[model samples]
Target chain A: MGASLLVLMIPILYRIIMGPTGFDRILGVNVIGTKTAVILVIIGTLFDRVDMFVDFAIAYALLNFVGAIVVSRYFNRTVPLQEMEKPKPRRRAKV
Target chain B: MKRTAFILVLLIGLLLAWAARDFPAWGDPHSPASSSAVSSHFIANTGVDTEVPNMVTAVLADYRGFDTMFETVVVFIAGLAVFSILRGGPNRRTRDREFVVDFEPDLIVTNTVRLIVPVIQIFALYVLAHGHVSPGGGFQGGVAMGASFILIALSWDLKTALARFPIERCFTVAALGIVIYAGIGLLSMFLGGEFLDYAHLAKVFPVSPEMARYHAMLGVEIGVGFTVTAIMFALYAGLSTDGRMRDGL
Candidate 1:
C-alpha cells in the first residue's frame, strides 16, 4: 500500500512543480503532505512505533496548514496583470 | 488523460486492498487487532483506571485522549478548508451552475432518501452518545451524519438541501468543537497529570475517580463527534453545491 502511494506521489510532485496556476500547485503539495502524514502514521502502527510517528503526524499536520496558508495568502495578495492598465475590454467588461 | 488517471487510481486502490488481504478480518473478536499488546493494555488497565463500559472508547477518549484531541483539530482544518474553498470566490452569491448526475432518480427513491435523512441523523446521535459502550465512536458517527447530508443533497435541489443547515454555521461549530477539546486537554495539563489526564475532572465530578475519568473522556468524545460531524457535513455541502452558493438557499 505504501509503495503504491509512493508511486502516486511522484506525479503529484511533478504537477506541483509544473502546474501553471499557483493555487493548483499549492493544492497538490497540500494533498501530498496530508497523504504523507497518514502513510507515516499507518507505517508507524504497522511497525509498532506508533508513539514517535503520532508526534510526527501532529507536527506534519501543523506544517501542512502553514504551507497551505502561506501559499493561499501569496495567491490572495498577487496583483492582477490587468491592473497594470493594459486594455482588454471584452474580458475587462466581463469582470 | 482522464481515463489514464482513472485507471491508475483504480489499479492502485485495488492493489492496496489486495495487500491488506492478510490483515485480520473485520470485527473478529479474537484477531490480533483485538488481542494485541495495546488492546491488552487497555483491557488490564481500563477496569481499574477508567471503569468505562467500552474498552475501545476508554482507549480513544482517555488513554489516547491526546490523539483524539488532535483528530478534532484535523476535522477543524478540513472544515476550514471546505469553508474557505466555498467562500473564496470574488462574489459571495454567484449563480449556481448546473451539473447533471448520469442516473435519473425515481420519485420513490427520492422520497425514500428524504425520509431516511432524519432517521439516519438520529442513529448517528445514538452512535455518538453510546460510544463508550459500543463498537461505533465519534468518527463512525460523524461519517453517518455526513452520509445523511449526502442523501439529502442527492434527493433534493441544492438550495433545498442547504436550507436544512447553514454551511457557515457548521464551520463555526466545527472550529468551536476543536477549541473545546483542546481547552479540556489544557485544563488537564494545568492540573498536572499530562496533557489529557482526567484526574481533575474526576475531582470535580464527585464520582469514583475511575468513573469520573470515564465521564470526562465521554465529554471529550462528544466534542470530537461534534467537530467531525460538522466538518464532514461541510465537505458534503460544498461538494453538493459546486463552486458557488445556490440561489434562495
Candidate 2:
C-alpha cells in the first residue's frame, strides 16, 4: 500500500517541479498532501498503531484542505489586471 | 548569480544528506530519546500518575502544564500582534485609487461547503474530546474547527463567515480560552497546591487526585482549542484583507 502511494506521488512531484502554471503546481501540491495523509495511515497500519496515527492522518488531511483553500483564495483575489482602470464609454454632445 | 545560488543550494543539500548517515537507523530502540532513562520513567509512570491513556497528552498538558499554558499565551499574543499591525483601516494614501474585488461565490462550491461544514465541525470536536485515547488534541482539533469557518468564507464571502463569527466575538472567545486555562491553575494554587498542579484540583472538586488531573487536562485541552480556533480565524481575517476587513479576499 505504501509503495503504491509513493508511486502515485511521482507524477504529483513532477507537476510540482515543472508545471507551467501556478494553479497546476498548487493542484499538484494538494494531491501530494492528500497522498501523504493516506501514506501516514498506511504506515500506522503497518506498525499496528492505527489508533494513535489516525489522528495525525486526520489533522494532515484537514490542514491540506486549508492550505489549498488559502492558496486558491489568495490567487483568486489578486489577479494582476483586476485593479486596472476600465475604459470609459464615449458620449455624443447634444446638438 | 543564479548559478552561484544553485551551486550553493546543491552543496547544502548534499552536505545535509551526507550528515543523515550518522543519525540512528529507523525505529532504532537504542536511539537517544527511546533509550533515555527519563522516557523509561515517563513510560512506566504516566498511566499511574495521570490515568490518561495517551502518554503525549499526559506529558504535554500535565507534566509540562506551565509550558503548554505559555504556549497558549504565545498563540494569543501572536493573534494580538497581527491585529495590532493589520487591524488599522485601509490606508488613506490609496483611498482615492479605490481597491475593488471581483469575487463571485460559486454555486457548486457554496453547496459543497454547506454539506461539509457541519461534519468538519463535529469531527473537530471529536478530535478535541478524544485526545485522551488517540493522537488528536487541542491544536489539531482547533485548526479543523477554524478550517470549517474558513471554508464558509471561501464558499461565500468574508462578510458571510464574519456574520456568523464576528470580530468582537473572536477577541472575546480568544480571551475567554486563556482565562479558562489560567483560572484552573490559579484555582488549584489557591486550594493549597502549586501552580498548574492538577492533582490537587481534587481539593476543590469531589474526585480522586488522579481523576482530577485527568479531567483538568481535558479542560485545558478545551481551552487551548478555543484560543487556537479564534486565532486561526483572526489570522485569516487580518491577512485576507489589509486588515480593513470591509471587503476581504
Q: Which candidate leads in DockQ?
A: 2
Q: Compare the candidates by lDDT and give the number of the best one.
A: 2
How is the predicted docking of candidate 2 categorized under the CAPRI scheme?
A: acceptable
Model 2 lDDT tens row, B176-202? 999999999998999899999988889
As a TM-score, model 2 comes out at: 0.88
Predicted candidate 1 versus true structure: per-residue lDDT over A1-95, tens digit per residue:
87788899999989988887666687897889899888998898887978646645654553344345334333332234335355545534222
**Per-candidate DockQ versus the true complex?**
0.02, 0.29
**Residue B60 accuracy (lDDT) in model 1:** 75
Error of 2 at B194 (Å): 0.1
The positional error of residue A30 in candidate 2, measured at the CA in angstroms, is 3.4
lDDT value for candidate 1? 0.69
